[model samples]
Each structure stands twice: as structure tokens, then as C-alpha cells.
Target: MKEVKAFAPATVANVACGFDILGFAVDSPGDEIEMKLVDKPGIVIKDITGDEGRLSRDPRDNTATVSVYQFLERIGAEKAGIEVVLHKKMPFGSGLGSSSASTVAGAFAVNALFDNPLTTEELLPFAMEGERVACGAAHADNVAPALYGGFVLVRSYDPLDVVRLNVPEELCCAVVHPHIEVSTKDARNILRGEIPLVDAVRQWGNVGGLIAGLEQENYDLIGRSLQDVIVEPIRSMLIPGFDEVKRAAIYAGSMGTAISGSGPSVFSLCRGMDKAERIAKAKVEAFKSIGIESDMFVSKVNKVGPKIIY
Candidate 1:
């Protein structure tokens, strides 16, 4: 194929207990990219939408085009020219893995154009390179799930090991994105570099339980395992109405509530659509009560990651 258009779903990274390790994909509010072959060498950003001119037009600075450039270089196809157009359907800095969606869409579209030269795992590093440019960290919690879909675990980063985890069908996600921007850099900077051993042990236990719960399709265990003793304590303080929103979600029958990625956007996992909708409503109302406008998304886990649209 000479041209391909693809879509990558939005992802929730750091899923409470599994900080920098766990994430899952949601069905809506993602990014789309179209990659077309050209005669000139190198890639160019043809267009960008829904970003209100905040995103860079230069291919080197943009996450999606940067990923495409890296993919081309890795395949020894830098001499081949490509044009990429990005559509940012999700809000930026909303803890919704916006950059990851674009990066995955770009890399996946480029790979599809070349008749699939790399496996999904092989395409990860190229996508992570884009993430590093966008957020200053080569973390896979967001990108892995956006690329492979479902739930993912970043077992190790040194060698870049990632595993796709099982997700229960009844488990639904409710996410609320407040009308506020929180820089990922600022969020990372505010975190304490050290933690008590007791808290670390609790976090480890929760992470292990989460993994087992997912594998066994145990909804109650999953809810019980959704505990964050480290990051959320520090990060949620930066987000307005976070505490109120969490409490409201729980009262509305959510399994558990936590900051989605870093801050500003809070997510809850519910047992089904009915409870998910209730949690979304409660969270949004809580934010509104705190004088913040927000958008809520209720969805089951997206099983397919990035895919060709045309």
C-alpha cells in the first residue's frame, strides 16, 4: 500500500498500583494519522488538527512524525519520503495518553504502508522514542497499551520487556478529564524520590494482586488491588477536586478511583456499564461543584490497538 490511515485509541497509564508499568486502552478520544509515500526523502508534517496550533509542525519536534521518522530509519528506508497528517481527537496533557495515540497511529500506519516490516513489540521502541520527545521519559505504560491494546505491563525497561495482560469483559472504565492542563514534567518533578519501605511493600503487593486478578478475570480482586500508595498521594494534590471526585465515584458504586496518568484526569473502574455511567456522572458533578468543567468517557477496554482505517 502506498498510503494508509490508522487510528490509535486513548490509554490510561500507571493504573494506580502499577506505576510506570500498567495501562489499558479505551475505545474513544484517540488520534488518527495518515501516511502517504512521496518521492522526496524524509518525512513531513502535512497537517495537524484539534491541537489549536499548540503542537509543533516540524517533523522533528512532533511526536507522530518523529516516530514515523524513527521507524523509517530503523527499516533502512530513510531515503523514502513520507507525508504524515495527524488528527488529535483527544485533549493534550489530559492524562489520556494523547501523544501515545498519535505515536502509535503514525508508527502503525507507516509499518502498514511497508507491508508490516516489524512486529508490534518491535515497533515499541520507535513509538517510545516519540514519547521521550513528547514527555522527556521513555515510559511504556501508555505507549505499550496504545500499540498492542487491552491491558499491558512493562516488566522491565532496560531491555524493554512488555507483556499484554488479560482484561475482564465486565470491567468498564470511567474517565473524567477536567478543563485543566498539567505538564507531565511538573508532575514528575513533584514526586518524592524516596519512599518508606512499608509503603513500598504495600505497593508491591497490590501490583502482584492486580496482575493475578487480571489473569484470573477476578473483578473483586482487581478492585481491591487498585491501590496507589506512592504516586497518587503526591500527584492528586495538584489536581483540583481530585479527592471529592474519588469519593463521589466510590459512593456511586465504582470499583476504585485514581489519577489516570499523572494529574487532572481521574479514572474509575466499574463492574459494568451502568455503574460506569454512574461513576462518570458523579465524578463530573464533583468537578463541577469545585468550579471545574470536565469531560467524561465511559468505555470498556479496547481490545484492538492501532489499526488501518483506510
Candidate 2:
């Protein structure tokens, strides 16, 4: 194939209790990448859209371009000339796995052009490399779900192990992105390196319960288990009107709510679209009351991952 285009869905990382380990894909507000063979050697970024020129065009600095470059190098095709174009449908630094969507789209598209040399799992590391360039750390929570879809658990990073967890069909997600920028780097920096043993034990129990809830398809268990005593207490402070917004979501019938990825965006899980819509409106209104403009998305869990668009 001489050219290919693909779309990758946005992801919600952390998923409350399972920090750095759990995530799930959402339908809508993703990234698209198009790649075509070129006569010139090496990878070149031809164009970008919806990013307000905030993202770098240089291959070395851009996540999508860097991922495509790495894929070429892995296949011993570094000298193969290719041009890439990216369309960012989501806001950067909004904690919705914006960079991961782009990286996965680029890598997935380029791999399609080569008739698929790597499996979805195999494409993960390259995607994480792109994530590292953007966030200053190699994390699989966002990239894994964006690549594989549904709910994912990064059980172990030592051997790069990942598991696709079952998600109940009735479960829905509502997210609100406040008009504020919170860099992933800044969010990570604010986290304390160590937590008390008491908090650690509480966190461990909740994560285990969350996994069990997902496996058992028990919505109540999942909601009760979605407590985050470690990350949320600290990171929620960075988001304006976080407490009020979360309270509103819960009062509006959301199962549980937490900061999405690094923040400025918050997500809640609900049983159906009706509750999800109410939660979204409540969350948005709470932000507005605080003089913060926001955007809300209510969507079902995306079962399909990245796909070739053309």
C-alpha cells in the first residue's frame, strides 16, 4: 500500500483507584493520521490541524511523527521516505489521552501501510515512546486502551504485560473538560513520591475490588470500589471547582467521578445515557458557576480500538 489513514479513540487513564495501571477508551474526540510514501528519505511531517500550531512539526519533537519514525526504524525501513499529516480532534493537556490517540493513529496507520507487521500488543511500546516524549514518562494506561480498546489493565510493566478487562454494556461515561491547561509534566511533579502505609493499603484494596467488580459485572461494586485515596486527594486540588463538580455529579446519579488523566478534565461513570447526560450537565454547570467554561462528552465505552479509515 502506498498510503493509509487511521483513527484512534481517546482514553481515560487512571480510572479512579488503579493509578498508572487502568484505563478505558471513549468513542468520539479522537485523532486521525494519514501517511503517504514520499520520494525523499526519512519521515517528514506534512501538516497538522485542530492543534492551533501548539504541537511541533519536527519529527523529533512531535509524538505522532516520532512514533511513525520509530515504527520505520523497527522494521529496518528508516530510509523509507514517508510524509505524515495529523488531525487533533481533542484539546492538548486536557488529560484525555490526546497525545496517545495521535501516536496510536500514526503507528497504526503506518503499520497498515506495511500490511500489519506488528500485533496490537507489539505496537504498545512504540506508542509509549511517543507518550514519554510528551509526558516525560513512559505510561501504558492511556496508550494501551487507545490501541486495544475497552478497559485495560497494565498489570505489569517489567515485561510490558497488559490485560483487556470486561466492561458492562450498560456502563457509560461522562467527561467535562474545563477551559484550562494542565500539563502532564506539571501534574506529575505535584505528586508526592511516597504515601503513608495506611493510605497504600486502602488504595490496594480498592484497586483489587475494582478489578473484581469489572470481572463480576457488578455495577454497585464497581462504584463503591472506585475510591482513590492517593492521587485524587492531591491532584483534585489543581482543578478549579473540583469538589463542587464531583459533588454535583454524584448528586446527579453518577456512580463515581475523578480527574481524567492529569486534569482540567473530570470523568464520571453512570449506568445509562440518561444519568450520564445529567452528570455531564451538572459537572459543566458546576464549572460554569466557578467562572470556568467547559466542554462535556457523554459516551459509551468504545469497544473497537484504532482502525484504518482509508
Candidate 3:
């Protein structure tokens, strides 16, 4: 059996206003997986790393392993018996698409080892099953960008058509991962079922503008459009120092700033690393100023998703 290696980057969902429908990738946050096809029937998970023993090898509890194996069973390839190992490059429950990145990498490694039995798009649902278990919501915004890369727009969730936009090379993102944990469930709980018509209109406008900004490479336009009247206001409350961090990012010349993936983690957009570094520092300081400790990732937009590295 041939050995295969696959990698996928973490994603930031809710990118401003397109909640559950929009996401973008960043460099630095990601996962890797290695797999080998075996002669035995059924898949067997072999190993894991970087998870600090928090992840499981059991199919039910293991996000990456379970998703890939179950998908194989669905396609009647369970007899192939794959041994897979996943490297968790990011923290679980970090709102950094940690599980999604692992799922994509593991799935791709297995699919590729077996000569790719499923189409790239077909692999989405299988991968999403992991998300379903992780977040209790099988949302595609994060996974789509983690798998496809660049700026992704989930046109429809039922069938999951993602439109990828060209991200300008100069675009930089500052991500602040708070030390505190906010489960996907708790974060979702804070959102209102129905928003006012005026708020909805404002959100839609921002969504349109974010999409346009990506296509046009307009930082100013993107910043203006990233505003949210509905989701952020509600979700922001869950994160301590949220308002301070956002304000600091903008003051530091960020084009836009918002919560990253049902977050306590907030991200900012800028045109250069220098600006991104400034933004990152400001966010960290904001968190500290409020007595909230956090870790920060200063990165640029990822143009590509899962791919072999080394």
C-alpha cells in the first residue's frame, strides 16, 4: 500500500456578516494527516498527535477518523481497511476550524490513497459529519474555506455550492484566540431566532459588500461592508473585551474586524503584515487591558487549502 500525506488549513467563519455562510482561510492554523491503505477490511485509526490526548481514536468521538471511515463505508469501500494518523495542528474548540482542517486532511489522504473514489465536492458532506459532532451543527462555512481555500461563499447549504474569490496578496489577517473557551453550542444559544427587518437589511448589505470587496480587492470597501447590526452585537457580548478589541483593531488601521467563528477569537483585516502585526498587538493589548489573556496569530489570507507539505 502506498502512503499519502494531506494537509488543510483552519478557517475563520462568520467573516463579518455572512454568518454560517461565509469564511476565509489563514496561514499558520491547520492540520495534517497521513494514511496507508491496508489489506484488512474496515478502517482502523492508528495514531494522533497535537491533540494533548483530548481527541479519541474511537470512530464516534474521533472527528477526522470517523468522518473518513464512515464516508468510505457509505461508498462501499469499507473493505479497503485504512490506517490513518492525524496531526492536530490547532487547538480543539478554538474556533479556528481545528476539527474541520483535520477532517479535510484525513479524508483527502484516504481518498487519494484509494485513487480518489469521491469527487472533491462529494467529500464535503462526509467531512461535515465531523463538524456535526463537534459543533452540533454541520455548518460548511468553515470547512468550505478550509478545503477550497481563499474567500468562500456558501451559496446554498442544502447542496453546498461554494464560490471562491481571489484574495489580494497584500491582504493580512490578525486573529486573536482568547484563552477562554466558548463551546459551539453556547455561542449558538446567544443568537436570536429572528432579527428585525432593518437589522436583516444591514446584514445583507454587508454580505454583498464583503463578497464585492474580495473580488475587487478593495480594503476600504471591505471594511465598510463588514459591519453587522444583527449577529455581532449579540455574539460580541459573549466575548469579554470584544468591543475594546474591535475598537483597537480599527484604530490600528484594520480595514475591518469581527468575531472569528462563533468566537471569543476576533480577527482583523489589513493590507500588509506591518499593519496586521499592529492590529494583532492592539487586540492582545485590548484583551490584556480588560484582564483577558489571549494568544494571537498574525497571518495573511490563504490562497489554497488542503495540500501536501513536506
Quick one: how many clashes does candidate 1 have? 0
| Residue pair clashes in candidate 1 | none
Alpha carbon deviation, residue 83, candidate 2 (Å): 1.2
lDDT of 2 by residue, 116-235 (tens): 999888889999999988888889999999999999999999988999999998999999999999988888889999999999999899999988988898999999988999999989
lDDT of 2: 0.92
Clashing pairs in 3: none
Of the candidates numbered 2 and 3, which has the greater TM-score value?
Answer: 2
Question: Which digits, one per residue and each the tens of the lDDT, describe model 3 over residues 249-304?
Answer: 99999998998887878989889999999999999999999788888898889877
TM-score of each: 0.98, 0.97, 0.94
Model 3 stretches astray by more than 4 angstroms = none
Query: What is the number of backbone collisions in each predicted candidate, taken in the order shown?
Result: 0, 0, 0
Clashes of 3: 0
Model-by-model lDDT, in order?
A: 0.91, 0.92, 0.83
Off by over 4 Å in 2: none
